[model samples]
Target chain A: MDVVLQQLRHTYAAPGLEARTVLMIDEWQATSGAQILLRGISGSGKTTLLNILAGLLPPTTGLVRCGGQSLYALPEDERDRLRATTIGYIFQMHHLAPTLSALENVEMPLVFGRKLNAGARRARAYELLDSVGLRDFHRHRPLQLSTGQRLRVAVARALAAQPALVLADEPTAALDAESSHAVMDLLQESCRRTGATLIVASHDPALATRFDRVVDLRNGALHEAETL
Target chain B: MYELKLAWRNLANRPVQTWVTLTVVALAVALAVTVIHLNEGLQRGIIRASDPFGVLVVGAQGSSQQLVLSTLLLQGLPVGNIDGHIFEELRDDPRVALAVPMAMGDNIGGARIVGTDEHFFDLRSSQQAAPAFQLAEGRIFAADFEAVLGSRAAVGLGLRIGDQFRPAHGVEPGLEGDEHAEVHTVVGILQPSGTPFDNAVLTTVNSVIAMHAEALAAPDASTTTDHAAGNDHAAADLVSAAETVSAAETVSAAETVSAAETVSAAETVSAAETVSAAETVSAAEAAHADDHAGDDSHAHASAGQVTAVLVAPVGFIEANQLWRDFYTGAEAQAVFPGRELGGLFDLLNQGQEILILVGYLAAVMAALTLFLAIYSATESRQHLLAILRGVGARRRTVMLVVLVETVLVAMLGALVGRLLGYGAAAAIAGEISRRSAIPVAIGWLPQVEPALWLLPLALGVLAGLLPAWQAYRVNVVEKLFPS
Candidate 1:
């Protein structure tokens, strides 16, 4: 379940502009079940690196191997499937589909997986919602939930597929200090319980001490911070 | 299945838009359906009403359409009568299979009392096998002054077996006060024949000839109050009565006193009211064939005179020969009821085409409305689509959900519209049966009704195509990440 990145670099091209490189990293590694922090200044491509690892964006010249499979080497649909089964995502603003309930948002990945019947999917979603302390609010829509509660639901949804790696891009940026700490505790606890690698991308320096490793994405390079 | 569920949930989320879209679609389908069914029913109703008199009509040469409309359809006013020799010629013609005489211009209430014999019931021609008249209650008319009521006529007038009603002199409204001394007794009530005959009161031509002769012998004995003044319009009442004096009463002119010509001499043939060349005949021995259904004309007491002769020749050759003879003859003109009806529908079909054109336009508008409504729903929910894509739902599934949503709404609306269209058409047919003698029965229109449902479904699919594509090509990262 370990994730390996080798010589990954990404660039953006628009008409009449030089190709601008967004992310470049020689190599990075995470053991299965390890928690890590990625810190950088604004516009340093911390989110871009996480997107590549999540198989959402292919790197310009590198290999992303999650759970021993090269992600970008496969077709887009297969890559999507691999992402569905092997990597989970937590966006910055708790982008839960408003059409689905809190519990249904957690169950969405499994629905796309097509591997479980309705009864089994419901049971799994119930267990996860209970684990995230959203059992009573399982039936409530995302709009009806508090900000912290919404992020907690997102944490439950990210772990629903039992992925090998979970990527969080500024997931707690909009929360209060206490709520941010609580959201982080829920995400770390959930990832630890599932033995999945956790990668948090944020500009906040205070989150540096809470992971097994800390990497700084600065000027398209990865530097290991001293403390982690 | 999951995609359909998601689509339905999305549609349900926008209740107002969904209902408005469905309502527009239903109304559009209903309008199209009504036009289709109405056209179908009216055409069939006209055929039903025309089936009994599928014959060549012999009448005085004027408006042939007016003759058929009055005699066969029991509507309008008869063109003047023809010589009884013409009726005898048709009856003796070897090619003619059926020939029944008609005399008109008398009424019991607003219902016309037609003078025809039992042979009128044996009608069948090129159109279809007309069900012969059978008694539902009593027997056919036997002696003069005995009447046979049509099925609907009996029902409408609330008459039964042996019920006697006095005859009025004419079909005009005030003529009920111009009652004749004869009290006609109803001897029979006919079965429902699904024709205009079902609304008429039928009797013997001999009886009509006898009654008119008695009126001619009495004072103020002009026919239709027209011979003296030639002014028997529907509203001619007291003035006509005050001026009722034909040459038969004033000049004691020959039985061929030229009633239709008023006081003028050396006039058109009907001026003598189609009185044959029977040189010697006394009153009460009048032509055995006149119908004074409105009592609008009185016959000269000749041996041969009839308003119209229903002649069902053996086949096309005989019918053509007979029509040619009458067309060339000076006394009367001949008419084919089916051809007259065909021309009527040809005119009516033009108006129907316009209505159908409007229906097509409504359908297009309904389809466009479906397109715009579905497009907006998908447009506003692009974020949700992006989220689903982000969560590993395939683009195809997202597209299918949108397509399924639009079609589901359209199909539901169409189902309801089909019901309403048929209901409206059946109601219209019922009205025709009530107001006129046309017996219209509307069942499922197998020929064109399926298109009503299928048209909307195809439009639903077509309308959904663009919106589904929009949902498919929704930019995932732009919507999800906003970076």
Candidate 2:
């Protein structure tokens, strides 16, 4: 699946200030199985662009097309179904259900899709957890696992549905250097094995150097950087 | 199915809050159901016990309530006696199916001694009904001085067939020499009728008259002394003297004086003529004694008085006529126990409605508790619910999960509460029976009560609404980002 954006623009309304444009992109595209890094400072619209591409937020004025279908042209529920089967999002905070075990948290995305029974869901969740090298920690909850281990579980969950696109917003932001590198490696390796297009939003230049492509968001415009 | 599992997991996550809410609901349901059961049971038991006696007529000399209580309930002071001829008139009437005459004044071991005849055993409330009295052992009294004990009377007094006991002059159990010198033997024991009759000792009307006659003939000194005070020697001396004169002679003398006073004043006779009349009564008494060997009706000389008459009319029309006839007469007052019971229940209905109102208020409080618990839980789980939405759960699914949790708790509370209600009802019924000797069975199942099943469910749905709506509208972006 290929992602396309055509003059995408988004705005936010404040109580007293005039409406402010948060994001503006002119003609940016990425093909399937491509690992792209989005680098930007705070308020640079790095997360906003990722949200638009995932169909989680519609652009205020412009078009977003993932695969061949226009993402914003569909109904809200249809977009949700599309996201469930086609896109997996990893948040900065991991956001694992505190009460669920590691294996159950990884099984969450599969519960929303069809063609998986209880046994099959468990089996697929186990396979994903093994891929992340957290198979022995399946019974541990999010609070019991280290930050790196928690992010690894999140990566496993993001790939559980075998989505075409994997979106990560600062997934390794709270991890130490060694743990951050290890998490990044696991995420990249999982995406490669599944042939999923990976887009990670972060400010870390050291992490950006490992991706196939890196784009910088500055002053509401996209800038292409040299690939590693 | 997954939504239900999630709801269960969420509830299980907070054990204390969940259990406290469940206990509140269960207590409310139990109280409401117990009130309903007890009210229904008391009404039913009273109606069953009151249905067997069609009407009662007592002497017009005293309170009607007292008469009905004494004659039908075997509980109050005996009203003054009416003419025994009233019993004959009711028995001979074509509209009257059966009439049992009662003469109640004495007691044996705290149990009422009811003076009635053999027809009393065969009497029924209506023409189509069967006899109410059935013997549990032995036979009905066939001769004067013989007694038949009711179920409770036999149990309470611990008397069996061939057991002899004397009656006290009044209704109280212990009055020393107030007990008549002549002893009456128990002949039979009646089955439990669940009526006032269950606590009465039955004998021929003659036995009542003979006992009173003996009590009146004895000197006043011995009558005041307590029989339990070791006065056996004095009581023996008096019994020997009374036996020498015979109970028939004493009863006959009392009746002759009563008879002579009824004669016209213009036909007044001399003292010598009274003595001659007394001699003639003595001869008649000897012949009556000889005839008593074969006859079961003893002491017929005292057939002039009775305490009350239990009249069974053919139907409502006959009953009304009897009521009017006796009401107008100067001798006795007639009453319908069913009508009186209806009036009593009418007075009770107001209290019952207030009780039910309180029950409903408690149910409302339970609903409030449920609403608060769910609302608070939703507030704490906003992030978790937002994550669920982010994972592709629809708004409808989130709302359904909350609703299902509320309903499950309500269902569990109702189920357990119904059992507790039944247990409470049984306990109350047992207490009622123990105190009043009136058997009250626990009423029908709680499921039979619509309020018991539907109130909790309706409240659960109503209480779940706000929280469910809140869950439905949770914003995944705001909760996830918060920036």
Candidate 3:
């Protein structure tokens, strides 16, 4: 399913600062089986546009259609249900449940959907962890593991549900150069294997080259190019 | 299910808050249990103290009420006395089945000396089924001037079968000879009855009569030199009443003659004429005597008299209606034992009502406290609740999980509290039984309440309801409003 943004605009206002339009994307289209990179410097609206595409934030003006569903037209509950079933989120911080082990955290969505008992859920979580090369540390909490290992666990958790759309915000930002490359490789490999569309928001042009398409965000506008 | 997990995790996350709330609930449960046990125990004690024998009949002149208050309840002394003639008429009446007559006003060696019949012994002693006035060591006295000792009296006076001791004339201290009617033998000892009767020295009515008769015979007996007084260096033999003659006997003889004309100057020293000492003799003796005459006059004098009777009905229904007719007739006062007991219970139950109120209030407060604890915890878990909702846990399921957790806590607290209460009851039951002279076998049975299981279970469910409702009504969409 292709994602469409027609005259999409987002604005931000603070207590004392001048109100600014953070994002303005018109006639933006990401066709089925296409990858898009949102590239921008800090405060250049890369995250805002990606968030709009992820259906986590609504545009101030105009329509946003993700996977052929008009998110804004549905009630809040319906929109949340659609987002949970279809979209996979990978935040910069991973936002894993602290109380659960890595395996339980990965299987959390299946448990919520009542699709698995505790034993089945744990088994599926283990398989996903093994796929992400975290079989040895599947039972470890996020705090017990290193930053790179935690990111790997986050990737396993995001892809466990096998969603149609995966959205990652700075997925490799916390890793060093080598770890960053490995994390990017794992994310790309998982998305390719599952045939899911991946949208990543980042400032790195090196990561942009690996995707099918790269779009740059400059002066609150999108251009058909990636900048180093 | 997720909300329950979150609740448990949050409880584990804050150990102090959880412990404080649990401690409050536990203590409240314990207090409730204690109050229930105390109220129940006191009620049982009252019921035990007032069973089997329901009504008491005493001398009408002396206030039948006072006799019950004093003899049965051990609260006061009688205000007047009834004579042997009246007592005999009542005892021989068709309605009278069993009568336990008691006499007061004497103390022997610091123990009460009771003048009563063998029936009094039977009335005071209760065994497994029948009474246990059957002698413990020896036979009960078959004649006057012979006595039976209570268990405590025998032990306290160091008296045994065949041992002799003088009765103290009144409830006052003295080994005076005037008080010593011929020294009475202890023929039997009564078995323990767990009552005030155990502390009394009992003698037949004739023995009490003989004591006063001998006091009349020898007014100078106390003046005689006690031969056993300087007997530390001598044998432990007591001087016989026949051998204790002294100069005081002359004065005593003169008074006896003046007191009785047959023993007066008209008769030959009355040596061969053994005194009959019956009613006719006593009335004639009073005519010749001054103080004896006053006693005779008092004994027979009755300006106001009521024909009193004690009726034991042939059947239960007849017994119940006996008092009703008396009430309707308005001329007589008839008391049914059970009705009197019910009245007594009514009077006593007023205090128990206060206890019940306080106990009910405590239970309500406990429920409210538990409600508050669960509600506050759920309120603070709004964010976690939202996360659980987003995870796909049903609202009803979340509420049910919370309810189950609360129910578990309540059940556990109730169990612990009940155990503690019973343990406390068992520990003190012995001392209480001893002091109050009540018989209770100490065992594992909790005497608090038979329905105690229901109390905690119901409370747990009740306390869980509010939080369960809150969990059910939680809105999931509020968490993702900005989306």
Candidate 4:
């Protein structure tokens, strides 16, 4: 699925201050199976743009079309269903349910989809866990795994339903250099295997060199750079 | 199903909070159910004890309330006995359908010995009802010393047919010298009537007179001996002949006996004519002596005095007339047992209403506890709920999960509380049965009260509303990505 943003804009209002635009993107697009990097410092609206692309946050002015469907124009529940079936998101903190095991967390999306029986869901979850090199630790809870392992489990969970678009916001922000590289390699390799459009939001500029395209957010504006 | 599974898993994760909330709900439900059971059971017991036929109790001039209480509830002291002639007057009156005389003030092994006649067994409080007394075993008292035990009395005293027991002179058991020397034999056992009658031992009025003969005898030696010798011979002859003769015939026969000759030949009589002559002279002397005996000794062997009379009028107008007649009479006071019982319940209803109020307060407390448990759970699981929403659960699903969790807890508490209520009522009923003659009926099921379960369920659902709304309004973006 292709992602298209047409003159997208978002604004936030303070209690006593004027409303300020947080994001303004003019005609940015990414093709399917493309690995794109969104790079920005803190408060630069890189996360904001990723949220809009995920259909999580609505744009104040403009249209967000993912796979030719107007994301914001659909009802809230339909958009949620679209996100669940078509988009898999990875947060900066690896928001896996603390109570559920690694395998169970990966199976959570399948529960909401109602497309797989319990046996099929478990089999798919185990396959995802094996793909992420954490098959032996599938039964372990989030707290029982190391930082890199937890992030890997989150990545496997994000791609559990074989979504068309995979969004990772600062996926390796809290990891050491070696762990970060390993997590990024696994995430990108999984996305390539699934033929999913990969969009990674991060402040690290060096990581942008590995992507097919780099969209930089500076001064609330989008700048597209050629793939390395 | 998934929502229930998730809710269960969430509650399981916080064991202490879950158990504390459950215990609070259980305790509140138990307390409320107990109060309701007690109030309802007491009301039912009192009403069952009340006679619907409207019996007018005529006793010696005294507290009519006390008279009714003693006669109907079998509680309190008996007001002084009225003239036995009052019973005959009521029996012969055209307005009176049945007039049964009662002679109380005696007990055998904690069971009250009610001195009445055979007519008492066949009598019913109303024309539409069956006989009030039904035998579970054996038959009614046919002889003076034969007794009919109530169902509970037979069980309590461990007496069966032909078992003889001496009764104490008063209503209480275990008086050192109050027991009568004459032993009465049990002839029958009555079925459970769920009334004070279940704890009574019934006998003929002649048995009461025979038992209290020594006390009722005159101070003069000749009069005492004449009555005793006459009663002994007639009783002996009646026992040997198996004759169902009236007390008047026995008295007339006893008056004809010469005191000296009857006493001398009482155990040595070999000829039937000599025995018949001795019985006649004894009967003539007894009647002559009874005429000389003053009213001071109202416990006379003859039917001259009685504890009270149970009078049933022919109609409402006749009943009112009888009541007016007895009310204005200088010798006795009359009371409607049903009305007196109603007044008694009216006094008890005030306390019952207070108990019901307390029960309501417990239900409210239970609701508050449920609310707190769910609210705190929702507050702590906001992130988890937000994750669920992010995973594609709708707002309605999340809300339903919370509601289901609350309702499950309430259903469990209500069931447990209902069981506890029944247990408490049974224990109380057991204690009451031991202390009093009245047998309180313990219900097997709480069918008498639906609020025992329904109120708790409603409260639980009501308590879940706020928490469910909170879950419905949870912001996935804000909760999952807190700044």
lDDT values for all models: 0.74, 0.74, 0.58, 0.72
The residue-by-residue lDDT of candidate 4 on B64-156, one tens digit each, is 777877776677666667666788788789999877777774678777777776667756757899887899999986545568998988999
User: Which candidate do you rate higher for TM-score, 1 or 2?
Assistant: 1
lDDT of 1 by residue, A44-124 (tens): 888788878877777889888887888888787776675566678987777898978998999988888776889998899
Candidate 2 clash pair list: B176-B227
Q: Which candidate wins on DockQ? A: 1
Ranking by lDDT: 2, 1, 4, 3
lDDT of 4 by residue, A1-33 (tens): 788889888997779989989887778888989
lDDT of residue B402 for candidate 2: 90
Tell me each candidate's TM-score.
0.79, 0.77, 0.60, 0.76
Compare the candidates by TM-score and give the number of the best one. Answer: 1
Query: Which residue pairs in model 3 clash with each other?
Result: B177-B222, B178-B222
- Write one digit per residue (lDDT tens) for candidate 1, span B1-483: 778878888988899999888888888888878877787777787777776675688887888777777777776667777666677778778999888888774666656778776677677634466545778888876545568998888987888886666566666444334655445668799888887778778876544544454345443643447322334421121212212434442232233233312322333322022222111122333332243222212232123356788888888899999999988889889988788888878877887799888887887888899899999999999999988877778778899999999898899889888888888888988887776677777767887867887889998999999999999899777787776
Every candidate's CA RMSD: 7.6, 9.2, 11.6, 8.5
lDDT value, candidate 3, whole model: 0.58
Error of 4 at B128 (Å): 6.0
Better of 2 and 4 by lDDT: 2
Ranking by TM-score: 1, 2, 4, 3
lDDT, residue B324, model 3: 56
TM-score of chain A of each: 0.93, 0.94, 0.90, 0.94
Q: Write the per-residue lDDT of candidate 2 for residues A1-228, one digit (tens) a residue.
A: 788889999997779989989788888888988999999998898878877777767789998888878999998777777666788988888889887889988988788765489999999999989988899999998999988888989888888888889999998788888888988887788789888899999998789778979998988889998876
* Error at B216, model 3, angstroms: 19
**DockQ preference between candidates 3 and 4, better one:** 4
